[model samples]
Target: MDHSYLSSKESLDIPYITFPDLLRKWAEKNPNKTAFIFVDEEVDRYELSFGELYDKATKFAKALIGHGVRKGDVIALNGRNLPEWLIACFGIQLAGGSPLCLPYLQKKNDFVKVCSKLGRVKMLIIDPGSDGQNCQFLKEMICTDFGTNNVELPEIPDLRQVFLFNHHASLPSVNTVAELCSREWDVDLPRLDPEDLGLILLTSGTTNTPKAVPYSHHALVITAYNSIHLMKTSGKYDSLYNNRPFYWIGGFVMWEVNSGGSRVTLINAMKSSSMATAAAAVKTCEIIAREKVTVALLVPSMLDLVMKKNISLRLKTIVTGGMIVHSSLLKNIHKLCDEFICMYASTELALIACNTFTEKDITNTTKGLLSCRPLPGIEIKVTEDDGFLLPAGQRGSIQVRSTRRFNGYLNQNLPPESKETLERTGWFCPDDGGYVTEDGELVVEGRLQEIIQVFGWKKMFPFEIENVIKTKSNVSSAIVMSLKDKETGDLPPFAAIVYHPNDEESCESMQDYIRKEFNITTENRMLEYLCVPRGIVSFKQFPVLANGKPNRRAIRQIILETVDSEKYE
Candidate 1:
């Protein structure tokens, strides 16, 4: 599985220096500076100096190499946000292998699926509590036992060896990755090229099969640049707290790894009460206020909860992504924080566009507008249906090409159509329909896949409908989709909204409000009658992913199933 043809120098403008190199440089530049801070076993906050982190990572790297792990092999690290997890990541990179970061809280099935997807994984590095028996790929499980006595070790049938970090056992040869870092070896460590795959992230898919996207070291470096320069991120504050899980692209690459020098605070507990939606929001707000957090990234849903709780934080910039940020939400956020930046990015591309709201830009029509341009080395083009480039102020599909783009899917087994689509150009058509304004600003309309066609007339985008509905008072979230019409034998647009749980407004009142606000009757007569949703169900809460994006697919399924069963009854 090793491909030595991919030279480390070929991967980036700066060859020989990889992500671990950056850490080493930082350590040299600021040895005593705090590299990381975490609440230790005694519930007391502990700090790791840059020099200490470098030492630990170097040893871990040597340990990995000592264990016969070679360049280009995949190493999977499964753990919550901890010092060991961070060390393992850099250590793996330093060892000349890619680190496959898995979600700490993943179920057994998902863990197995991810392991199966990563066919070339050489080893599994896990935290103390991980039940290796449930994991299918652990031929050699190395546990960095962080501080637990009652470690009910599971019998892994395929496991050939188990190495405990803090404990000594008559197991296979164990070298604390942190220990080998200082020893000098005659063998030259494999250099990191710009194009060398550095990490593998599993993206959620429509089907049960999860697709893994491998990112190069250059891709990560570009991600850091984009986060700092394009997003205008400032880490001058005391600490950085990211709520997103470490597994996802947004969490690991963009937020955690990119902000390398900052103190990354993570919430590891997962009980319903421990990580309650409201409590998470409040804790984040509190951290921002207490720690003087300069930059924070959260999903719109989490922002909504923070706003609802009236939790105030002294944040310089709060970047919200995962879903579109509503104008109303932005307006409310402005009252709490100084800047609210709306970012549009995906796992494939680090960051595409962003909109920042200063106190001045918060006024009048510029509220929910996306204000930034494409990142450096990125080219964006809007093309019409005929494959011709569209002029300014024209609506079309957004095609983007970037050096930071992912190499390809992990398996390299893209479907014929997908491969053809990608091969047409380096530009990725994420299926997002949008238009470039006269000022060259990209205005996202909606997903082409989610677009609705009713009879002969085309329907407005779901985002457009959702945006309008979201502006309504007490409406927390909304989704618009096309449902099959019994009479016309065609699909008609339908709206499903979730309002503030305690709101006492009647369905008729809400309907009237939507009808009046959207001018439902006058503009489009068909929509006024046909698009008016047949059913509007109210839930106390909205289903959301760990990263804060709405679980629309799950919600839609539940809605359909409930409605169908009701009809049958």
Candidate 2:
């Protein structure tokens, strides 16, 4: 591959530092400091120091080499957050290979799609107990706990070894692979370039097909820089705890590896309302209060639940993203936490823009509309429909250009020349309808694609309805969509609401309020007797991704599957 396209802004050329180099620097500085702390069911507490992590990673690298794992080999870590997950990631980098972090919730189709995209993965290091026995490519299985029952392993022609951390003394071992770790290796591992691929992340394809986004070592460094400088996180002052999965970019870049040498506390459990309840019940709140966790990243709904429940967690800074944060919810969050930072970002551009709330900024109705200046190494621009760059304060498609931007999607066709022109300009037309305020803040409207035409008049943005619904006391979260009307040949918008289980009356009141607020008079409306929601179906709770973002696509699918279309107007 030609490397001449890369350039450096400072002495620290991003493309020059690999993951191993970064880890080595941190280890040298904080040799005895704890790098990761995880709590497992069997092993109550698991911790690893910088020196210990480095040593283990070095041994794992040698183990891979001994098993014929060569440079550019694709390795997969397919399980929940654990010490071995980080170890496997570092080991792959040290052994000059790319590690693909797989989501624990992936089913048959998702798994098949990922495997196909990651063609011919050389090795797979999975948690045998957590991952179950359905993996298609199980070259090596490692159980972090010793007492886990040894189930029948999957049939893989390339499988070579199984290393159990706690049960290595009694498990049925095999040849061609060693149960030994870094404690047994005295040899040094190979190095990597900054441009070398570090991890392969699959983009969240809510509106379209999923694409594999490959991040280089330089890109990872840029993520760390953004976290430290742009987000203003300090190791000396800030303690971080992240429950997000290690697979997604938001989790991996923002939570797991962003702080460099700072300690990261991981919650190794499936994410759900029950899990949240269990965590709160276990006095995790007390632990957080004791540790004085200054910075945190939580999903909006989860934050709402935590705040509503009055969990006494002392947090100085709380940043919410990965989904839209309602104005009402934003204000409530501000009252709960010392400092609240609301951000809008995607995998393509790690942390595009964030709103750091001042006391005055918090009370503004435009609180959710504040525009953020591009980070040090990034550039942003807005453009019109004709592809002309728009000046400040003008509403147009927003585009971004950053040194941290991903190279391209794997196994996916590149956008056309016309589309490429839009992308190269760094003016991402997020297709979100919103204008930059006079104060240079970006106000995100609803998605341009989601706008509906009702009776030839453009109806309100879905976000508008969602925001309004969220203001209703009992409504937890809401999604509004335009449903087609068969009789009138018009698209009328309807809302699917998720309310507190006991708030049936509140839901009915909201329906009445919306009908009057939107002025949906029975005489003028196409469906005279039927208000908007031809059918109202309630869900126990909305599906949420590991990163705390609502699984809108999944929820939409569930709604479509459960409700009868013919019943509605």
Candidate 3:
């Protein structure tokens, strides 16, 4: 078999419509049906029906138009998964503006950089800061950047309006959502085409700075429709609980407003702890149990914490992706649900492939990462760096073409590094290296840039070493990253591990075991010495992104700092 696969499955006839049109259809069909559930904690839970949601969004859109919002304008949205966030997102599209979802960045400088890069954000809608002090600080930052009339900063010249949510702060030149919603206009909402831009998403900059990726309305609708069908196969279309933030791709693409009348549950990020903490995982399980959620989409890191709780939950299906789906994670997640769906996807191409794994699938698999077949309407191929096709069982760059591919970046003049992602041909490279097995299953290795290079040309992917470390019974999670040698300028791998709580084995002993495992040399392990990590460190919790994926960049820095500090002390 060749190293390419085209989905031969027939596709459902998904509707081609704009976001506003989708909301209209669902609202008219199921007026009283609960569209979304906002779970704040154990005590507070709020639900919005289809009719109420549609009416609120329509009013918000009219208010936006009264504020001089025109078609094709770009608006920046900064908030968590609140009811206001939902209204603002859909209202912007209904008013004919694309909403650019903002990541949760604390630094003022980071926030300024994002707005400057967009070059033409017409308005900004943000949440009220933590308290009065925070609100004051944010007021100063916005006035200094956007409220100044004296200095005409070429960057963000179009940003003249600002709106704050759920606050009555008397900040200079700042508008509140209440002020906007109170105003109504007799003007009709603009009719938009299906190909109009829907929203802009920021990529996870694990290796580099995040870029702005835009998607059209039709693309988002089709993506969600196909995904609903895929999940329906396992009888999991009733209700979903997703903790991933609205800024992330998994937040919107996985579930959208449609005629299917699917219900979604969103956790209050302000009340919840970080996903790295056991508390957050406990809260996640609690919500799934209380809300009667049939399906949940989580990252592997969050699942790792839930599995450690040893508390079985009642759910129909559990979906996970956005990290290496470790075999151990797969082996244990079954206790919490009836079935497990592992997906391989990215922000560029939503939902590449997914498979429902069971106890038997995990027991029989020999690969470190399980292989999944391509989803319907997607084409996968293994190719060399120059785009030459590779044969089956040969590792190479992985490229994909799908019907739901994203529109070009907001800044089409991409940086040199990202130029190779979209080719003159239609194929887009996700910068991953993998191959097709003889059975036509796609097995993904880690990112090609993450390969560890030691003394000369001998290099290996970090997953090779990570798989070996995970074999230990006491280890909960392991991540291997390449560290550079100062004197020889060689890159050797080092491991960062999190052990099971209350385990009798000490960190020093685990380090010694890893070192001893690498030193063992046999005919099959001759190159094992070269692949060995230079050192090992223990972590209580790994730093994670807003999307719950491990923040590899931050993790690398912490590992280096911890090792260096220990060496000096």
**Candidate RMSDs in order:** 7.3, 6.3, 4.0
Ranking by TM-score: 3, 2, 1
Report the number of the highest-lDDT candidate.
3
Clashes of each: 9, 9, 0
Which of the two, 1 or 2, has more TM-score? Answer: 2
TM per candidate: 0.79, 0.80, 0.87
Which of the numbered candidates is closest to the native, going by highest TM-score?
3
Tens digit of per-residue lDDT, candidate 3, span 66-178? 87889999988877777777788888999999998886533466456777877778887877654444355465565444333122334568787777766644555556665
Model 3 alpha-carbon miss at residue 272, Å: 4.9
Model 2 clash tally, residue pairs: 9
Q: Write the per-residue lDDT of candidate 2 for residues 1-569, one digit (tens) a residue.
A: 11101112332234357767767776777777766666554435567777777777778888878667777877766666766767777888888888877666455455556656557565656654443332323322323222332223233333333343222223334321224463465455666778888788776665555667788887787776666654567664566655567777666734324354344455454543224443553455554554456676766666766777766555677777766566556556655567777777776667666667645655575444444555556555566666666665555565566756544567575667535764565434445655555555566666655555556654445776666566677776677765555666565556677776687554456677767755777566653223345445566776665334457677666666655566433
lDDT of 2 at 215: 81
